[model samples]
Target: MPNPAPVPDHVPPDLVRDFSYFTGPGMCPMRGGDPQGALADLHDGPPVFYAPNNTYDGYGTWVFVRAEDQRRVLQDAETFSSHRRIFEKALGYDLPTIPLEIDPPEHGAYRSLLNPLLSPKRVMAMEAANRARAAELIDGLAAKGHCEVMTDFAFPFAVGVFLEFLGLPQSRREEFLGWADKQFHGTPEERGEAIRTVIAFMEELVALRRREPAEDFMTFVVEARVGGRAMTDKEAVGMGALLFVAGLDTVAAAIGFDFRYLAENADAQDRLRADPGGIVLAVEELLRMFPTVLMTRIAACDTEFDGIAIKAGDRISCPSMVANRDPAEFPDPNRIDLARENNRHVAFAYGPHRCLGSHLARRELVIAMEEWLKRIPAFRITPGTAPLTYGGHVFGIEDLRLDWEVG
Candidate 1:
């Protein structure tokens, strides 16, 4: 990036002591993943500085983004690996998550197994039922004066849809819900505890699937002797855990944000209330605009971008929240115009490593928006409550509190 207009070099005196320990290594959130602070740092300069592990994000600041450089950075994925070192170190296992951490020719093998499972046709088969389920979920909460969207609605909505797709039994609902909340969105200490709990449950679940071999994704994985030998017990457990960890929180955040958006924007809410038909595209645009989950990829080989050099093995993150809001691509980027042109956002990511569950996620969002809009025709945000924004870059939420009059 070319040099920018110079601003006065003034660091607050109190910030002086704070800066002493501030990695000065740029904006790694792991060192302390504060969205407001990170965005502040981003605005301060370009070619962002970073360390493998910063406080905001565990391996915080290394994942950096310059929206203008998105296309080229993703195109050369050979060197930008998704197999995060920090993540592997934390998990203590080199477990397979397939196309997620693999590169090129070898990656295609895993996709072969996953593609059929996540295909549009396969996903479409489940949509009608999920929509009904979503509608039912909203029906339970629509007229209430106040309700917590995440716990009462969004969390269960996404998890239930995923469980249905995997053919997992419904009895494990509370177990999965508690564990998922702690694992990703929980505090650092809580995250560690959540990981251990999830492993135990997944282990038992995988073992059961191996023995009976139901016609679910786990069964397909357990019995498929092709590509990779019938997946080991641990691998099956890990795969289930991976999907649970990745899918549930993301969908919840998206749904939660959709509600928050509508609660605040009467015009937008009115449009959808009169006709839920607008939900399909509106949800897509919302997903594009508010990326609740951040994307991470590690640089495998030394690379250069827009003249700045990225060393091999350097961890980097591209928060879709930033890319999706890019001014260059979306005119009046902040406005929630459902008709925005050239609307592809990296919210689901770019390149071949895009979300395998996109079909399911898209349908879920559509169903979620449609069902909620109809039930919640005229609702307002609770007065004296904080605004809703996805909380953190890694795992965020819409946290909207809405009330509507009955009769």
Candidate 2:
């Protein structure tokens, strides 16, 4: 095991916990592991504690386990800044991931510019295409009897929709998927290379859109104005890079986890298959139970939070999985209630930086489930195989071999 970062003197010794997203119990890669469920145990610990070596880069972070505290910390952006320059280490320079890293007043303008493009109405309009894409992928897989979820349907379907939105050619689908895999799951050196590769692609895309404007997201960004001025090259590249990274990974991972859940729970699968209308609500419940992202913030200045001393630059981690499982937030938090009401779960996060693509993501998930159940019959994890799950910057499942009786 690598050496853990030293705990800051200001952090009370009693508050420090030997926890890490990369190395925590059930967090590491394991077959049939429940990374998110493993984190639910955090509720039994202190509401807030310092976790040494929690981040991908080996920095200590203050972990908030309760939904209420996470909401407060996430909602109060000024105190806990979101501008962590997350891609700086990989890119070797500071490149804020657009509106995600921008705070409040400045964040508002960028969000306003992009929100309408992905609003509920817009997502509804895109549903037909999304549905068609999901159906096309599922149709191709139905005859196979058994297939790996990620490569067979999840990544292709999710990334296809993302590529369509970005106006990229589907011919490069495999190439783009390769970059995404490397960036998210590859070794450190490979991840850096993938990051650089994606950035280069985005830069080229920005230039292409500027010179030969098209009716696509990149083109819109190239010509769009933010803060009463045209977006700079860096800003355009940042936006595209953020979209490429964000759009490709999380939704696909979500689809993987969602299918894994259905594969294990035949009753849930049968219910959703019998009552397709319930899928919309079921998707929300599934999201609550298996969220994959961890929101991290850097302290803007030293301040006391709930009697805890937080110094400037301290990392605050608000794990959506842990928060979603907070008993105070959701009664019987571990129960998989398909008809869960008033969920208000933070799968997309809370406050100003809530995921901009949440609407699109929700639509994609709902459509995926609807199409799968409509086309494929009851299925389960293929016998003699297991889905490998891991926790890190993001939680993901792989080798999700699912099987069903063939005609």
Show the lowest summed lDDT stretch of 10 residues, model 2: 1-10
Q: Estimate each model's TM-score.
A: 0.84, 0.98
Clashing pairs in 2: none
- Per-residue lDDT over 56-132 for candidate 1, one digit per residue giving the tens place of the 0 to 100 score: 34333343445666655565567777765323434676654555766776677776777888888988899888988
**What tens digits encode model 2's per-residue C-alpha lDDT throughout 326-406?**
999899999999999998999999999999999999999999999999999989999999999999988999999999987
Off by over 4 Å in 1: 1-64, 85-87, 387-393
Cand. 2 Cα-lDDT = 0.92
CA lDDT, candidate 1, residue 176: 82
Please report the TM-score between candidate 1 and the true structure. 0.84
Model 2, runs deviating above 4 Å:
none
Write down the TM-score for model 2.
0.98
